[model samples]
Target: MRTHESGRLVQAALAAITAAAAFGVTACGSDDSASSSSSAEKPAATSTPAAESGKITADSANKGKSIKLGSKNFTESIIIADIYGQALQKAGFTVKYDLNLGLEDVANKAVEDGDIDGYPEYTGTALTALLGVDPSDVPKDEDAAYQEAKKLYKSKFGFTALPQTPFTDSNSLGMTKQKAAELGNPKTISDLKGKSQNLTIAASAECFKRTDCALGFRKVYGLKFKKEIKIDVAQRHEVILKKKADLTVPFTTDGAIAANKEVILKDDKQLFPPYNVTFVLSQKAADKLGPAGQKVIETVQKGLTTPVMSELNSRVDLDKEKPEDVAAEYLKDYL
Candidate 1:
């Protein structure tokens, strides 16, 4: 067995290497295989997408007015909103924040009802969850995928789809370092599909039924586990660490993913939504915030990436760091 000190050193090195040059695994499978994909492995993927379509033009109402920025009830979303609000303020636009606004329905409804002018969302989610697309499955190509969503949003909701950051934070598979090493340097989702039957998984109670979690991954990926242990969302990491499960399904941008350098399995098949947190504004909010809103969103996109966002999330949600202070520190980097 490796010494604890040796393990710690190895983990530290892995974290440093990944932070500088991130990696991803992409497999080609269908929705049916998605839920079962845990049993397979695929080639490691580079996070860069093929190409993004240009932003679509639309009618806007800009008049240098202040806007209320709303965020969903999650650490990362609230952090992004803070970054955005700060950016807007820097650009001479008055900004208000209603942080932790729950899920997209709440945020989208608020915008539509004119309670708030703008918020952030992901492309795949914006299409299916917000716009009601069929299948409710995630898209394979980020750039091409969001274009369909962009059109849907403009035609249906009268909202502007701003530039989407190239960050995908969603449900995914992960393995322990010891397990990874014992498996002889496992790296792709395809590699695990056939092997998952021998391992157990632990996750939030809802994960077992969520399309992106146990369902989508198993259906398309063809992974069959020995067992799945349902635990509270906050207890997932502890369960995994205690060896209750061989791997855990965690959000891609989760702080745990970063702090522990947990190996995120490559989603050879695009099974989960691209929750890149796109900035959006109501038609009226756009008219009022205009260039101000654009600049704020832009700064946030530059400042927040997968690693940085994951770290910030851990600080607030896991470490119990105050949200406002966390936001201030991140904003200082760009402000």
Candidate 2:
């Protein structure tokens, strides 16, 4: 009873309706009903959608959504958190910060308790500290470690770990250039084996207990220091510079290393696990962020290679720039 033109018109109308329904389903879902598996499996997009036009612009879908971002009590963590927060803000999400949230356990609890929607975390820390995986059992391969941590996070806590950043900030033995030269320029931790007996090493008390720290130096590299001084992580570079300690445990990406103030002794035996950065978000928050928001988070991190991150840290630690300001400057290109 219908003409050919009428049938085509009906089909078009139905297609429009179907498209609208699909979008509506995505926009309105119960907080708990969202599945993290899809988001987790989706590879991070290499390009920023909002920046395609040469400037970041707000998405209508993200305008009303809010995300609470948190970070551990460290300069690098805070800088990373600020980067994520500012990028989300540009995408029209109301980002609330809960920075300096203490240690890994405290930050984990904050995310679990909904005190924060998410935070940037190291894959090694998440595997060992949060998931109870032994550090030795943690995968040495970066992608493999990230996947294991992501799967465990979802199963154990119903959280989602977004794509990892390009950089990996693992613990390493560092000493001043002068001290290294004095030690005959030991190029690797193994080179310190026989010489360690005369060197005074310093690190946080926890480092003495971790297999990846003083324990690893002793076991894996057969290095035993003359004296192990318990010092805070903040004083790592200072201790070496002040000559209080001949060597100190520092993160590979420490600003001091970037500034050439300290030399990282290579882990020839690979004692430390990969500590790549991943943003851990609640299932509910991940669902609300959806694919577009997740892409924004991933895109901004694409530029954060080890050297780039080290420089960013140097800006804050050496240049004394605020993390927020440093983040803003870094995001300018994306904006």
Candidate 3:
């Protein structure tokens, strides 16, 4: 659990002032009079307060309030949590980060137990994982999935589900370009029919049981791979890169796909349900945020299209940048 105070802007302002004072002292001691004069004439640097500089404005109603935000333990979730947390901080709400809270069930419990005020959650995950809805029963349409999840959350947990992002990060089968070429460049999962018999597939342990993954491949596509390897979710791409597996289960918006390190086959049969993200908050927390705070979250998320999110994920997964740093940079456009 990590807590970020709203004092960051205050610290930046102090630093700017200190730098300006040092510049002034240096100008007074300069041997070059003309250079000193030029320096003296130049305006001192200023630090703009986030609320003033950013599209998200501080609301008087949100002052003195704090929101605890959490995320599932994944690159995309961490980055998204940071983005929402930082944006709320700018809007006069003291934002606390309780990130890397493990999987959907863990995050759901955290919010329910008040360990976190809210967190980002995928629509399909809410239905299939938390709500106990079968994968086969999950809605295929993105909006329909979000609405069902939203309705269920409200009735079951008194949670408020915010509008979802444009991107849907559903489960997908991915392979290297070379591997795809060897398989005759199959464009869809159905195309892999007989070829799967010779392929070694890899995925997280749970995926093997889930209807949206290994089970789906066998039941929906009639695929029977030569071997099924249980790997860590984070290592799905690595196994493919190392040629240990011919195919791996990955999220549609995985950074590896964005980097072209792996290519996702189209899910023509739509085995996986829509997994668009939305902020789920406790009713009390939602009331605390009010309309202004809600607007701030919605506004910041507006720019998170699939490609944009993939690139942000790539910055963390491929470029080795910190999630918080990537989020801060992303918020710059809104700011």
Candidate 4:
């Protein structure tokens, strides 16, 4: 539980963010009342247990006796990485971490080279970004996905993918609070049908090109934007604030959206793939953790959900809480 102490510091920061996220967001949405309250509200839905999703294999037992944890450069990766590190630590293995690693390619190289164990990745991101496969047209759920990804990973390299969860933090659509009200779109993708085409959008070149972001929304919702503006990634808030873009792409769990009070549009057509955060374990490290790794897997398997992950992300990115601290505090809440 020593990790808990570290986590509490994160929780305090998250609590502060939860209390003060207004400074970071651009406030997009038609539902101003609901959007305004999302930050202050303690989650509203009742918890429903998710079906089992991960495993600690004999291969893993013999392999992950001691593991290195890796993470991408993003805040969510940092938090998830800290959780993975603490879980391995509690399971009785010594963990070394290499957080803030660049991306899947870098993390994959590190894991393959035995520099780090494994890290979290999204199903869509791996298939679309890393592997050059199109997940946009596939069924928008997780069944057979782990198996598909495992085959690709093992065949391409010696790595392994653990069970995936329902925790999704995918790209979303957002507008200024006033803009949302002006648009009058609500509750579904079709709501914007005749209008979105006139609104200018701003996002990453990737987001603009990706199926889930622009294409999917257009196809599924029968809507098209009048103009699309490409900007550097992660700078949507600034663009929206300056009115450079009429609408922008946002992440559902992103803290900046909530902090700025940006009104997020609903994806009624379910155009996005479910990118439940998953543990992509390095084969080398899995061998060192032994049976204790299974316990760690179980602990993680029991908690992560869309709502849970969304809040955690909001805390770290918007609230200014450290990812490591948020992970630790989250473990305390569920453990």
Candidate 5:
């Protein structure tokens, strides 16, 4: 398949921030970052000839051994780690956690060093941050992105990029509902072309430099802001809610978007890369766990949808519920 390959050079610089994505993220979860009102079809468990049922019981699936699970330092990552760790435990694997393990760089190193087995990851992050692919080269179609990433991880690091969760946590441009209405109800990024001069934008501090954010607007959509402000992910939504910025970048699954009732602009240009969550397992660990491990991981991925994940995030970000507890509650249904 022909891949978009512009901005290949800028990927080197963006790679650094992609590793240190240690800051908290606010996303609504889905390959679709715009219009949280829509839901993607939930994926079924991974199909492997190793088992008749989609789920494989851990005890029957693998020899008794310990699996070291790791996660980046964020609520969503931690919660996902627990979901996988806890499920592995139920399957009778001696699961140990290296949770809150800094950033994707740290987690990627651990996996490469054989210090851990696997953890959930975003397809775009793994593609750009780990595999050195240009963001423009990333496939916009969710499954295409996953397939491209799967091939790269297997070839580059001898790792397996398992089937991704239906939910994605991609970046989005959002404005107040009123602001969107004032612009004649523009829906897609292309709609903002000539309107950029009237719009003030805000995004993560790195977005100013990252091609995926502000830079993507100019390069991909031909839009340039009248003014741009840098705000941490934690406060980006507030800037939009307060009308201080006409448009702000927020993760598609960010709980704040729902909490603040903001409107997300569609990325009709297909500029941003897919951030669909998937489990990237080392070839060694995957060989050891076999189909049973695939079942465990796929079950977790299959159960999560955009709305379900958003609520899970809300429990941690808004309700102050522990990620572990939230993970436990969500796992009960699948396990």
Candidate 6:
């Protein structure tokens, strides 16, 4: 965890590093295993069709010389890094691995310093943590958020995000399926308007005042809670199960939603900015990867969907499977 001051210090360091480095790296991966690293030996891989077309042919570029993949310390981040690393390897690039790169500050600074090529990052994380944008200032819609993030990264940090995946691990309002059906099968946030006053909401103590939380709900969907109860997120589902609260906020990829058979309401009015997973890379690295590497990354992005990512997360968080194994399984059809 980082204090606001520490976070800003990291942002400052990243800005300095980005300015100093002459070469940058891009991330790509999937399937065959490789050891983790801040630096490591090149992993072996077979060429895929994308690489065979000579799109990522070694002779075409030499700035970075090698593609080094980095990932944050979470299961999801490690798995994503593997996916990118494997794809680049199959695309016939000499790839290196750097998993468990700590928090966003550490990871972003590593990228800026040319310690690694690229990594998967969420838009919301970048906006608030890196760009210093307030949560309320984040664009509500996904495309708009991505576009704005791209511009912010380029202008502020000397880098940009690759084309984004369709899946977004964003905040969502959830209720038991039974509860939703009882309310005439409410599918969108707007559907809860009239009935919300009869319901209790469960969230952190300060959520009601946050523009991206209760305040956004009230303004965007006209929601008015009968009671606002401070509840720890881990116990949110339990509260609903015990009939203490009618609604709770859950991450879109939360396993509890499936376990409890809860339905996440659609944010039809786009009150919250969606955090689509994307590859964050510097222009130096992007140029090195050339058209072939870029195509591979975009292909991987096209394959990911909300349900797909949720299931992948469940396999690790709920089933306790190795993220590498899960990612490899998904990559069987990923390209």
> Compared with the true structure, what per-residue lDDT tens digits does model 6 show for residues 1-335?
11112233333333433222111123333322322344554543433232333233233243235788788755567777776765566555677878877767889998999988888988877886678788778987888888888999999988868888877888789898878888999989999978999998898654565556666788777788899898754565788888888899877876668777898899888777778888998788888788767877765545466666766666666666666666655655333
Supply the global lDDT for candidate 5: 0.70
Q: Higher TM-score: candidate 3 or 4?
A: 3
- Residues 1-335, model 4: lDDT tens digits: 01123344334434533222111111111112111111111111122233233321123222234556677756666667667665555443545666667756777777778776688887767766665667555447675555667667767777677777656677788888888778774645577778887888887776656676676666567677888788865577778888898888776767677568888877766777767666777665555554456455645545565556667777765565566566656765554
RMSD of each: 13.3, 14.6, 12.7, 11.8, 12.7, 11.5
How many times do residue backbones clash in model 3?
A: 0
lDDT of 3 by residue, 95-166 (tens): 666677777888899999998889899998789878778888998889999999999999999999999987
TM-score-better candidate, 1 vs 2:
2
lDDT score of residue 292 within candidate 3: 77
Q: By TM-score, how accurate is candidate 3?
A: 0.81
Badly placed stretches (over 4 Å) of model 5 are 1-64, 181-184, 242-244
Query: What is the C-alpha local distance difference test score of candidate 3?
Result: 0.75
lDDT of 1 at 256: 71
What TM-score would every model get versus the actual structure? 0.69, 0.81, 0.81, 0.71, 0.74, 0.65
- What TM-score quantifies how close candidate 6 is to the native fold? 0.65
lDDT of each: 0.62, 0.75, 0.75, 0.61, 0.70, 0.69
Candidate 5 least-lDDT 10 residues: 31-40
* Residues 1-335 of candidate 2: C-alpha lDDT, one tens digit per residue: 11112234334433433221110001111111111101111112123245343234567667667788888867788888878877777666776766777778888999999988998999998888789888789999999999999999999999999999978999988899899889999899989878889999999887787776677788777887899999867788888888999998888887677565678888899889999999999999999999878987776776676766776777667666677766766665222
Report the C-alpha displacement of residue 261, candidate 1, in angstroms.
3.7
Best by lDDT: 3
Model 3, residue pairs in steric clash: none
